[model samples]
Target: MLKLLSTTLLLSSFIYANNVSEKVEDFLDDKFMENPRLKSVDVTVSDVVPLKQLAGWNAYIVDVEAYLKAQPKRLIKQRMIWFSDGRIITKELTDMQGGESLTDLVKPPFKDEYYKKENLLFGNPDAKHKVAIFSDPLCPFCKGFVPGALDYMKKDPKKFAVYYYHFPLERLHPASVHLVKAAAAAELQGDKNVIEKLYHVQINPQERDVKKILKAFNKAVGTKLTPKDLNTPAVIKQVNRDLDIANAVMVGGTPTIYLDGKVDNTKKKYLKVQ
Candidate 1:
């Protein structure tokens, strides 16, 4: 391997003896034009060429390693990234911010109250920050917001208050209604910590004994209620409120979230994932 590399280097040196820089550029240009492997490389280059002019997009932050390696001086926020070295790597961009906008948040014209008043549901009443989450009980997308979301909150609990609501696509999964109802009922038991656990952890409806969920709910979050307590009228009322809010918000699917009401349909704000 070492001898082959040495021979290639010697041959390249001989080929480029007089016009080294020109020869190198011509070689690369020819490779760029003719090689299919280089064609794939061109795609990466075209995707990022906008960066040269700083005509940005929301996808520049993806493939942090490739972006960093390809353009050591650049800072990208969204989109794909790639380059050839001795290794290969890539990533899909998330968390879009608009082009040429230095601020992480985009300005929306309406007051947050507009979205909140329409969609807000089960959460701590006195909580400072509000997040409305639309989730199907049985959907994997909804389940993605689990322990990861909790960890995100732990960073700054005071700034993150999540409102859980069910947008169960019951026609698709008949079992979703029961799970949504149980989850809503769990919320009223006054321990969001436990409710979130049950929301995130207990997903399987078949093996899901109501007692197991209630047990995990109890053990993880120390709620002040028996399973029967969730059957009360007040709990029923709370569950109804959650469903009503989910309906009002036009929650189409599970795991849809409005962040502080700033990211929603009243405005055309594209959601940035965590």
Candidate 2:
């Protein structure tokens, strides 16, 4: 009788959680409707990551996809907070002592599976330190930092293993989506220097057409890859996987760095890693 009772409670809890998530999604949809610029909006909540419980509230990191009527071709991805006291939902929470946002305080930790061999951009896999970077090729800050980090890994290959993941800020750099896809395709074709070479490629950031991006990519990377090459199932899958991992890790911007499975806000922690 006790076993059956426990199972029933578990099921009820699961149902309650689902209901809360649905309500959060609806709230976001309604909120977006208030924007006059967005004629119509559809909000899809992809992941509701639970965080440490506050005094009587449950906190969640809500990953949202907002499809706006004004921009049918573009999908906006955003991360928001949801604090619930069972009946009421609030959007923001902060730590009073340190003034840290809940999102920063409870960001998910890196999983071991994230350190895939295919994502390794440089250095020995078994090196003493593992550095993972979520970067956008077109982001000026990434353009400045990534190459220098790669150089450090190259110089001391045994000291650090660097892995690169694509986190294209499509809204800011419309061209980066294609560039990242092209880089993935190049990697599939055994191009070792494609990632480094791509930073130097002079392509218009506002350009969105695939053909033009491919033309520039091929010329600069010295590869004759066509649009079909960049759109192959393998290349598409690789880019998607990288983006998914970036989302999972709550990477909001380019050049988000991780050292030994922890967020490195300064992004230069690897320099001191012995």
Candidate 3:
């Protein structure tokens, strides 16, 4: 009887959370519709996880994607806080005694699969310290950070391992979609240095033409890969897998670094790895 009661409560909680997520989506849609600039809005509740309880309310970390009108290919992702007492709902929650925002305290823990051998870009796979980075080749910050991280691994190969994952901001750098795919294609062909090489290659961020993008990529990486090369099943699957991992981890932006499966917000924790 106790086990059955526990299972029933769990199901009830899940249904309630689902209802909350749907309500949040509807609220966003109605709010966005009021703006004349936005032709339409589609909001998706990606992940909802419980957070710490405050005074008399419970908090949840809600990750959402708002696809705006006229920008069908663009996604504006955001992390929001949902405070509820099973009767009232609010968006802000502050821990006065702790002196921290509730939202900042919540971070998605890394899954074991994130350390897959195939994703290792530098250093020994058995290194003592593991660094995972979700980066965009066209991102200005990633352009500087990714190479430096690679160099750090080179300096202490046994002490540090760097795993690279693609988190291209296609809305900002339209060329990155192709560039990341090209890099994946190159990796499939046994080119281990493709990630680092692509970071140094200069290309217009606004350029979206696939052929033009490949021309610059091939010239810089010394791989004469055609668009067809990037469209292969293996290459596509690899890129999609990277993207899925990024979304699962709630990677909001480029140059997101994780040290030993924990969020390294400063992105400089690898420098201290000895």
Q: How many residue pairs clash in each candidate at the backbone level?
A: 12, 0, 0
lDDT of candidate 1 over 1-274, digit per residue (tens): 9999999998875453323323333444454455342222212222211222222232121111112444545432212232212122223222344343222232222234433432334344455666666666567655665445645654554555555555666676555555555555655544454445555444454444656655544554455445676677876666666555554333445566666655453321222333
Alpha-carbon RMSD to native, per candidate: 18.8, 4.2, 4.4
- Choose the strongest candidate by lDDT: 2
**Model 2 ranges off by over 4 Å:** 1-26, 29-54, 63-80
Ranking 1 against 2 by lDDT, winner = 2
Quantify how close model 1 is to the true structure by its C-alpha RMSD in Å. Answer: 18.8
Please provide, for model 2 over 133-234, each residue's C-alpha lDDT reduced to its tens digit, 9 standing for 90 to 100.
999999999999988888877788788888999888899999999999999999999999999898887899999989998889988899988888878899
Maximum-TM-score candidate: 2
TM-score of 2: 0.79
Model 2: lDDT equals 0.82
In candidate 3, what are the lDDT values of residues 112-178, reduced to their tens digit?
6788787988788888988888999999999878887788677787898888898889899999999
Model 3 lDDT-worst window of ten:
52-61
